[model samples]
Target chain A: MFHNDGFHALDRQECLRLLAKVPVGRVVYTRQALPAVLPVNFSLDTDSSVLLRTPASSDLVRAIDGAVVAFEADDFDAVARSGWSVVVTGRATVVTDPAEHERLSRTGPRSWVVTGEGVFVRIESEMVTGREITVPHSTD
Target chain B: MFHNDGFHALDRQECLRLLAKVPVGRVVYTRQALPAVLPVNFSLDTDSSVLLRTPASSDLVRAIDGAVVAFEADDFDAVARSGWSVVVTGRATVVTDPAEHERLSRTGPRSWVVTGEGVFVRIESEMVTGREITVPHSTD
Candidate 1:
């Protein structure tokens, strides 16, 4: 359904489907009690959890472990003035179990940059919301 | 200079230049003490402040007014595995002065959607940082 402002609200299933199509997204987390955002490549686990693989020593892992964060991804066409955006909010936890780590290492997202031993951070898909902007039909 | 992870750090001037090139970005804020992010089209003011125009009664106007917020914009080439991202953190204030509002109405960003009377939110460019990911040269 379209909101009063003309944005179409996307259902949870649709949101998840759209999210899996994109390889990169922005992670929102708190840094020193203020908001910080970083663009990272991510993947969705079978259960729909957002998965990120980064250097175990990266600052992002330190800042977001066990913290409530938001992940957003979108595709926009400036020339066509149409796009869709999805936001997922949930608690992020670092995967520590060696077996799970090994499984994720084999199945999770690959790091865009090669670094030291990699770690996996998972954000539960607790809340998912999305909106789409459609160009109104030309009256002419 | 490249960081240990091979990401090139962008200076302030370069960040602003890049920010202006993108017409849309994500705004990060705190909602119910958790991070929230939304895609917004923005422009840089003469003083380099991030200016967003939204419906005066929009939820974003209420959530970000007089609050610390983060704005981020980036462009990436998935095939080439390269891109740059810039983040700006600062205080967001609603433009209330009638003269300033009028001036911004003429000079600020145009909303992607048409709505009721619009309000202007300016995010000071207090802390700006960015990084660039360059595809590694083929050793072959």
Candidate 2:
């Protein structure tokens, strides 16, 4: 029953549920002086952050390492007439620990970039927010 | 028709085409010794560049005002069992001209963030790359 003008605060369970449903999302960060947004494949971390895979040679790796970032995911079906979106904003860390990397790498995405490519970055969200879109039910 | 190890060099037209079909993507930036990635709605400009509307108050705006950035878009269809992705690396500029903003704003998108939100940020690409997921296609 969320309205357009009012933000429906999301609880932990709702946030997790939304994240599980959407596979692709946007990651926003600053490169030089303007905002840059990129499409990424991510898995939800056990701690509730977004885990993304990238190549070491990737510009995304270079530009976003050790920076503040935002990660979002959503789904819409015009025919079904329903959709939802979730956003996770926080600081990102490059996972260098072999054991941790190995664990994440097992479940992380295979870079759509290239073969022998690897997931070099990981982001842990500090704050999460979400909302949904639905046709207003008519009482008539 | 291009492949390098794993990276695919996608021309401008290919990037624009794929970008148009996808609705969610991520933005990456660096701030305070960490990397940040956020999801956002975006469009391909007439110049075939990536443009995003964001809140002026957002940290994304503060990071990209005069910085280097990168953008990405991708499409995935489980039914067709096919997908393609485009990545743009470049510098970002905030569009201030009313006419330009208004014109670009007309394209399709329903930003979850507030309007009067912030100025629009556009990325002027220097390098673009793309790839298609093919079960039979091998990089080796």
Candidate 3:
């Protein structure tokens, strides 16, 4: 990994690739003005939208829709002292149109919760960015 | 794990225990009024406060002092369909007291970032809560 400035700045493609590689991410949302982060098992749609399934009646389901939120995923090598983290800031919209619902159902993610329900929310990336750190070498 | 009032509520002691077990966590802070979650390697202090090391000039270190932030960590068993996530909402304070600083240096977390600096911030938990889901025996 090469550093663009001080930290490695990942391009759009690499960011999407990393997002697809990790099934679990934490979604940060503001509810009643307090920031809350929830772990979600999500999928990356072909169009590069982050898709997640939650129950229709859940508060998370209601809070994320039309709200600006962030989804983050990372994999770290603790022993090597390196890792990559990607954060996407976006606005979420629930799939309510029948055609979109059918299409998403065929490609959207499944929930990790035991009694998982089938309410799908798609977060369209408004700003996608990432940073990565590599194991330090003596010569560098 | 069993659920109380439809959510698995973890007690204070159990929450701190789990916090110590996990070396990595995500710290959620508001940056320019938007919520951002950054992965952090943290340590639990004897007083049950969460501590981490970041550079003095870093935005996180500067913004978090006296601000409310959330520290989250979790362990999940995918195939078993069970896991617990703990969220600690607290106020962050920079370690400035010399005697306390010396004591913390012996116990505070070390940074994972290459060329790690030693600016310490302690997050005192005001509210601790967790949720867990168990395996489903019935096929849906």
Candidate 1 residue pairs that clash: none
Q: Please list the residue runs of candidate 2 whose C-alpha ends up more than 4 Å from where it truly belongs after superposition.
A: A1-9, A107-114, A137-140, B1-5, B19-73, B78-82, B86-140
lDDT of 1 by residue, B1-140 (tens): 22766588999999999999999999999877778898988999999999998777778878899998999999988767789999999999999999999998889987777565588999999999999996572221
For candidate 2 chain A, which ten residues in a row score worst on lDDT?
Answer: A1-10
Cα distance off (Å), candidate 1, residue A85: 0.8
lDDT of candidate 2 over B1-140, digit per residue (tens) = 33443334566677777777876665555655444554466766777667887666666778776776666666776444357777677778888898877776666244544534446788776777777666543332
What ordering of candidates by lDDT runs from best to worst? Answer: 1, 3, 2
DockQ for every prediction shown: 0.52, 0.23, 0.40
In model 2, how large is the Cα lDDT of residue A110?
54
Error of 1 at A38 (Å): 0.8
Residue range A53-88, candidate 3, lDDT tens digits: 777777887788988899988887666667888999
Measured with C-alpha atoms, the lDDT of residue A58 in candidate 3 is 74
Q: How well is candidate 3 docked (DockQ)?
A: 0.40
Q: How accurate is candidate 2 locally (lDDT)?
A: 0.66
TM-score of chain B of each: 0.93, 0.77, 0.88
